[model samples]
Target: MHNNEQLPNQPTGCGQFDPRFLAQIRRNLFSEIGANNAQGLSKNLRQQLEGLPRNVRKEVVEEIGDQCAALFYACESGNVETVDYLVKVCGASIEQRGISMCSMVHEEDWYFCTPLGGACAAERLPVVKYLLELGAAVNGSSECGSTPLHIACGVSRIDIVEYLVEHGANVRQRNHSGETCLMFAVLSESLCGYLISQGVDVKARDLYGRTALHYAIEGGNSQTVQLLLEHGADPFAETRYGNDPLQTACLTGALSIAHYFIIRYNYTAERLADTLELLGTTMIDTSNTQAVMYWRLANQLRWAVPRYIQKRPEILPRSAFENRVEFSTGADLDAIAVDEDAIRYQGLIILERILGIGHEHTIQVMTDVGYQYEHSVQRDSRKCMDMWLLALQMRVQKHSILHYKTCTTARSIVRLMENVLHRNVTQNDPNTLRFEDVFAMFQLLVSNILETRHLLSVQPISRVQQDNHDNTVRCLTHLIYLLLSTAGNQTERRLVESSVRDLLRHDIRCVRTNESLLHLSVSRLKMLESEYVVDKSGTVGIFPNVNVTNLLLECGADVDAFDRTKSTPLHTACLPLNHDREVVRALVEHGAHLDRPNLYGDSPASLLAGNLANDVVLGKHISLKCICANTVVGSGIPYQGIVHRMLEGFIRAHEPV
Candidate 1:
């Protein structure tokens, strides 16, 4: 290294200390301190401090003043004679506050001033002894409420910690967060050993109700955790979240610490079994089946299947049964190949096994492929009825399929639907008449079949009596709506009208009641109108039969049902955005809440805002009721009157906006 004397000076133009001069002082200071001078010569050399700027000089003086004030710091740090000179000649004083140098001394300074914290950190003995003998405060706290003992314990400085404890440093001094020295020790192995030697309280808890053992387990320091347990840290201590250390360790995948707790705390096999069972149950209850599988896999890999069997033999049998199927070596067909009705059932079984095997990417590919196939089938005139039936069957089967419980499975199914819908809308063809018929059929299936099934399944059976006759009537009503919506030939129209009249006279009294199902029905009805409602006047009747809307309302459907935009049925119908106005009028008559805003902040009135003629025609008799009364109105006013004009002028003048 170059000597400080050879270094270049700071430019005069800088108007700061010569960088070279400062560098030389720094070099000499470090060298002098490292030399641990034993004579008065070092003190006489202090005159060199005058060469620095006044501000720099003050800083150096304050720094040296601390050194001079804590003479024992020098002595404890093995600078005996230099400390003597500083104390005797420099007027260094020893105050009752221990080193008493300055409040500026940091936590790291405690380690440097004396060997107590350092020796504890490094497991040194003689250095610690000299410091203790020279009146070093073994229990002195730094800015963070950390004592030398805390430092020693935190870093596993067993020997220094023991030395400090023996010299009367309080073993129980808590830090800013009420974590005691023993708790700090549990953060590291060496400190744990030192605290154990000193008989420190190991069972102490922090402000968060976390005991030393909890920290050890949470920190995944297995050796420290074992030491804590050996010293009687409570294994059963629970955090504010009601989770014991073991559960926390398990959740965080700290297997070593978890095992230590289990072994040392005498955690029973039955208790472990119960924990696993509860974990699985909670996963299902919280819709976290993915986590359930992860935990199960962890238990298998870490402890081995034998241990799992010993805990819960039932899982082993289930696992064995599920994995019994043999997959083909190199199957390379697209996912849609499995969409055939005969193959779908087998494919579902195979897919469930694939999921169990954890081939997640493969499952995703299969779901995507299956969705594409379903879309193609819907768009093929010859395959429309088959596709609809297959979709209905697949949806029903999903409810019974255990595989669908996982979030991944649910997400895959949703992606499948989205892909199918996109493909169907893009592939419209005049030759595909049956394909055109599929949209109306889908509406019937979703509204009449799916909704009724879900209602019966979810409703409180004990609270209501079932009527088989009413079910038929409802089914017939759905068939009539489908027929009218798909009215192509006069024959089909007459058949549908006759069916509607017959269902209207039926004594059965069941009506559609589920919102999602109702939305599905309306969406399907709208799709039908889009495909087949062109009229002689060059106008499109993209409206569902008015009777269908009336029937839905009678069955307790909200006439003003909103889309994700909070756009009511009337809003959807009235918007010139390619929808049916007649449908909008029908919904308005049936008591649809017109004021509900969509996600876009547009209400029925706002949706018609751009169409002055339509707005004038509809706005006169419309209600201004809001879904959420406290809702703020948008910027546009209903009307601009004289009062509004005066307010606008006053506001503009005051705020200049």
Candidate 2:
């Protein structure tokens, strides 16, 4: 009667072979290895095998060897008694390993080694203790060097981690990724204290020269980073790419860690030399050091500013850039000048980073921020490339085109456009994109064929970025929708739409409805295709797209939220003109309501019937979906709208009673 109780011939979750013969009939198994029955039932198979004639029994036993029948299922389910019975009574090898079919397909060997690894990963304390007592190799690694210790730390199994280390497991051994048990321990703050006490190397760097401190910083685990540092970790250790802990912290957006590092590394004269030393030059020259610091400040700010603009701009304190500089505030900054200082110190670069992320009040904010006088048009003309380009492109006035003549060359334009379109723009994705990204988005969406051809004339983006063009498409569509849906000035919309046909570029004369207001990027679903995560309970779920979806949602895109015509993004994704199914799957996976009706009172499933209008049987197949809106409104109300009546009835006949 239990939910996971196996039917007679089914293989349990822990990896048992269903006889190829029996696989044809009722072959479904438990979705995951369930709790093992403590009452030994290893002999249950004996009765089934004994019922066969002598020759048939011999053949079945030969086909499925005694070793194979030892089914690691008991260990996976943590059934100590069942494992004991299989080992003692059925002659199963105590150390017999099980090859995980899931691991094989995904190329991730979580349960790759002996059953003990699976037991440890499952945090089955009793099963693990039993296996270790039975002489299972404590240091055995799977193909990926994933050991019991690594698994324990990953799952935050502190008790099991302490037990394994106490029982001869090597605490300092690195995995195939060159990460140590301590590196994995970042996942468990509790594991860090124990591993360090057991004498694991607190300062061990990975192949990338990233110490546990770097991992901790990247993980936003300030507590763990502090723990590692207190245990003698080199907080000043730099990666091979020259990223010190603070710089790495900045890149990873761990502002708290960066702040902590700053307070510790700076805020005094004692570590000023040390801070400069970490920047990687043995220099006594104060001027050179200040310049380098300026550049480093710019480098860090360039990344930090854009990110802050997009998601956490409000968090950017007035003194955020103050800690990086040594001079008193408002002192002699003008003397240095834009071109005179590091590229990071350029007025245009600072302005673009702060206000260029498509905000309507960007220009006014510049004026209010009191930096406009500092960055006058004359200065921008001389130093800032982005401003120069914007001037050339947006200035429809008589002399705006003169920027190209006065400041830039023809070859420079092509080179700059190519670099902007291809590299910087792509790197700045919709998730974290600002001015450059918006520019590229507009270019791709609004530009005509000749313009697109011209942009790609240098080098085409061959399968750029994170695999497919889904993210780009999603970002552009979202941008277009945001612009069109907002009650902006008609002149602005007309100008923008006219400039880029992709915005609201459809023919008004056409009869068909265009779901421009809603966001349904078919490419969005393709994002979820390969993303996955292994939970604490050892269950794998396809939820890696959580970040992408979360970022969009946080940025104010709605799921059940509809466009002007009442179509939600989900309804838009399922349009017959755009039935990627993946888009629908992605939205549903991200918690979109499946049965929600659109403005026209039609569910997403009902919209799929549009493509099948000519096919009688398929139309009927989606019938129940067709009447969903009417059903919700009440049968007594009757279907009043004539527009949806034909499509609804054509499909409604197939609805289940």
Candidate 3:
């Protein structure tokens, strides 16, 4: 026999309902029953099924109408009469499956549930009993391997759970994630106790090796946690990620659970101190006032009064807090409790000590701690720069210079420099920012850009690489503006000039847009809308930056070079949002044509004429040589063969719009 062929006694007509009857079932039977008008729903359903042929009527009982079978809907709605009518009178299959909309499993993915599973999830005890009496599989599972018992326990239907166990529900069965019903029942103390008494494993481990005690602690129910502990659940059971119950409790802010474990469990002193430090750092990040309590607890465990120092790990990094806390006494903890900066720095110190300097999360916390200092009421720029600089150095060592983590850390440092420079210039606070430090950071930023340009030269770039490329260009422009602002001496000015020349010598352009440095500096589109472009100190960069433009021009950047839009840098300066005539005069001085056109036939002169309509002196800015070239171009005579190639190209650029 063929594999596709059905046996003679096998039910073949199931799910073969007539189209009209299926529509009627959806239109009347399901809606009315859902609206709680089940008194006549059975009669309405039977009448609708009677119009179809016998085979169709028998199959219509199991036909899936609206993402589920009619019997499944009847079970979920608690309409036992309709459910019985479909099973008995219409010969419906007791184990019919359909899409479950209210599955206890993952709601984001699709899961198929049996009618018995649906009834149990809805807490329809009567329908559940009837379906079980009709011999529906008590252990029938959904697509996610969740049985009726799993559903009952998840919804805390204790009565149904007891009834199912009295019959034949398996208490030890695990779902797809290897989670038993007891794992989901840990939220309810009574349900957990009942499941334990009925042979559910108190020490059951999920796919991740998490025990019921982990779930109990995560639920924040001290009573449930105590019950699980009394029933022999391991308090120190670690998951695949090495998270014990106490670690989970700390991460979840379950103070009572942490306290219970601390007093009741026999953890070693060093392990307890580490976990307490983790808890303290976590609480500090959330602004919880209780952080000092945990820190003091850890401190007491590590150091006792009168002269007792804990054994220290050899070769600790400079990022560790060993230097700051070497001589701290009880009075130091009290000081940290009142000082916000002390609390924040203490958190960073503890995080780095526990997670190590090479960990990514440690580097991220360093950056965040730096931000807290930079933006806090104290405005400690020196400390902020120190932390950010450390983070940037570590990120560069761990990942490539073009990596997103490295790029983000570098961007933060650049933003800080800009803010400090703006403050120094506008508020006359020169001591707030240092020119040497900003110059050093600028050198690193330029090296990263050059390396990225080299990578794009020999290889195809992904979308992320393209974004990093654009970000580097934007950061470089912001730094250029800052360096110009802080150039107080000839030495500083010479350094800035040399760096600009080095970049232009590389022939670098934005890989994504193919825009030259001059184009990005002139337009300032990307920098204006960047996510890191915060102007909290009102330090917005100047638009159409004439100094950066002139600097690029002096560094051998093509003043009339065309971008991807086929428009020169001069076209960008003439834009409505960036219509700065000083930049226009600078570009014209650098030999930019007055009548150069782009792909859209919009020349600088044409655009400027529309923008500066009242400024009749605009013509004075256009030299006589440009006017003659514009005239020759408008005459449409063949100048390509009659003139020098350079002059022919100039005439072509001056074509009238």
Candidate 4:
């Protein structure tokens, strides 16, 4: 009773068994018997006969060998010879597992509890081949409906894949996970290359709709990318996440992959143009100083690239218009068929170039367009003009205002004033002057006119009756005095003096009552006398008739009035070391306070004594202390507070000590 021996009463001929098949089955059964009992089968003849058919049953009964069962056991034990013998000699069903109880089990279902499944899990090529020889269906399902090929692929067994696929394994078959063998190959680069060479579908996608190409891009594998692309994988194919391969490459900073997609792949012309434009604009937006540099480089490459400029000849070549220029000269001008739309588009491109360079070229081009086709360029021409004007205005105003506020020293102011005067002279023509220069000049001219008018209206006895008349008078007088002292030429001086004298005799009594008029009158009279020593009686006598010094005395003009520098009238009048003496005498007799001490501790008497004779009695009754108190109080709170505190401290210190 060998384990592999056939049973005599086994139902073999019951289901269409041919003699050749039965003989082969019997031979396999005998082979299994020999291997199961290595010592040899039992010698008793009745042992083999007990299960044999009876004389009547012998005609119908055919014995089936135990080869399949023996081979299953051999595979479980990893016995190579026994499994091979059973497969070749027995003619046992290759798809059958070992005999189970009373029936033969299908090899496909045997994976439920068999060591054969374990062999497949270990990725043993021998075990896979042995099972296939014993009629193991290559595409047969396991317990969970996964074929052996599926299990092999999941384990990334390249050998198993080769063996199974060679032996008619279904490559497209999926497991319960809905993943094919190709997906498994994609998980391993070696496996992927092997499968691709073996004709595995590289374009196959998984349950997530991601193809092998998608995975390669996501992983940023340059080798895999090149392989897939070489095999006709679409570079422009978007993933399930809606990102194209190029975008993925850029985002991952995969330079190699990006270069392949951009340079090797035949991307659409429009898409290439748009992508480059976006890159350029984004780089510019992110930087400040080097924005133009980046933009120009980007655009240069974009234009030079044949894909972007093949059809746009207007933008591509400078000689395109030269041809048209010659053609237009002929009598029959070929219908003058200019592509205005194309020209406009080219204009936009030129504009972008101009903005990037930020040079005079852009302005020149725009100006040329305006001049060449002024009537036809109504809308664009106006826009160009506005842009030029705005740019110029910004440049000039920024320089002028910044200099005036930050650098107000005498030397700097003088230089700035000289520059302004020079520009005014040089750029007198409105056509030649930039908008910024014109704007600055307009402000200056308006300011001068308003000041001149105000001075004429606020002069004493002038007819200027209006609601803000006092403020008007004060502002006008101050402006006139500044102009008189700082006027750049004789024209400015004459204009200031004329306006001052007109206001001095203005019919309006309120204007006549303004205290600033008397000060302006004396200043103007002195300027007239200095400018014209012999003919000074004309304008200078106007002040003498009004008697500014007397008028100021009546109007409570502090003779020792000092500005922030604390210079008294006498100290200021005696500046340059040689002013007219009659003007000084008039100021003195009209109650000019002579004993007033300025911030520098110099009295009007001391100021005059330095240069003028100290014994010159200009006034009879001069309250020196009153004059000093008036000037001190009018000098603002800091100076006034200092004087009061000093007096208080003196009285307290003397009383205590």
Cα RMSD for candidates in order: 21.9, 18.4, 14.2, 40.7
Residue-level lDDT of model 3, residues 315-397, one tens digit each, is: 34354232454214668787778777667767666665665565565677777777777767877666778788788877877
lDDT of 1 at 360: 33
Model 1 spans > 4 angstroms off: 1-27, 34-61, 64-130, 187-199, 219-224, 260-294, 297-657
Segments in model 4 whose C-alpha atoms lie over 4 Å from true places: 1-120, 142-146, 154-156, 176-178, 187-194, 197-199, 218-221, 246-259, 266-657
| Per-residue C-alpha lDDT of model 2 across residues 452-499, encoded as one tens digit per residue | 222222443322221222232333444443334332466755644544
Q: For model 4, how does the per-residue alpha-carbon lDDT over 1-657 read when each residue is reduced to its tens digit? A: 443434334346655434453354345444544455543233442233233334322321223234234444445445555455445433333444333211111112223323244445555567667777666667866444566666565566778777888988877776543556665454456766777787767666655455667666656678777788778776776655445677556434454676677887677654554344333333322342232333344445556656534322233332212212111111212222244423332343433332321223233333333333322433232232333333333323332221221111111212222222333333443222233332333333233334444444443432323323433333343333334334557775555445445444442222333334444444433222111012222232233223434444444555644444454455555443334466567667766656555566665666666664444463454555554444444553234244578764422221211
Number of the top-ranking candidate, with TM-score as the measure: 3
Off by over 4 Å in 2: 1-35, 40-46, 49-70, 89-111, 187-190, 267-657
Q: Which ten residues in a row have the lowest lDDT in candidate 3?
A: 1-10
| lDDT at residue 330 of model 1 (Cα atoms) | 18
> What lDDT would each prediction earn against the true structure?
0.46, 0.48, 0.73, 0.44
> What TM-score would you give candidate 1 relative to the actual structure?
0.34
Q: Is candidate 2 or candidate 4 better by lDDT?
A: 2
Pairs of residues at least 3 apart in sequence or in different chains that clash in candidate 3: none
Query: Which 10-residue window in model 1 sums to the lowest lDDT?
Result: 528-537
Score every model by TM-score: 0.34, 0.39, 0.57, 0.25
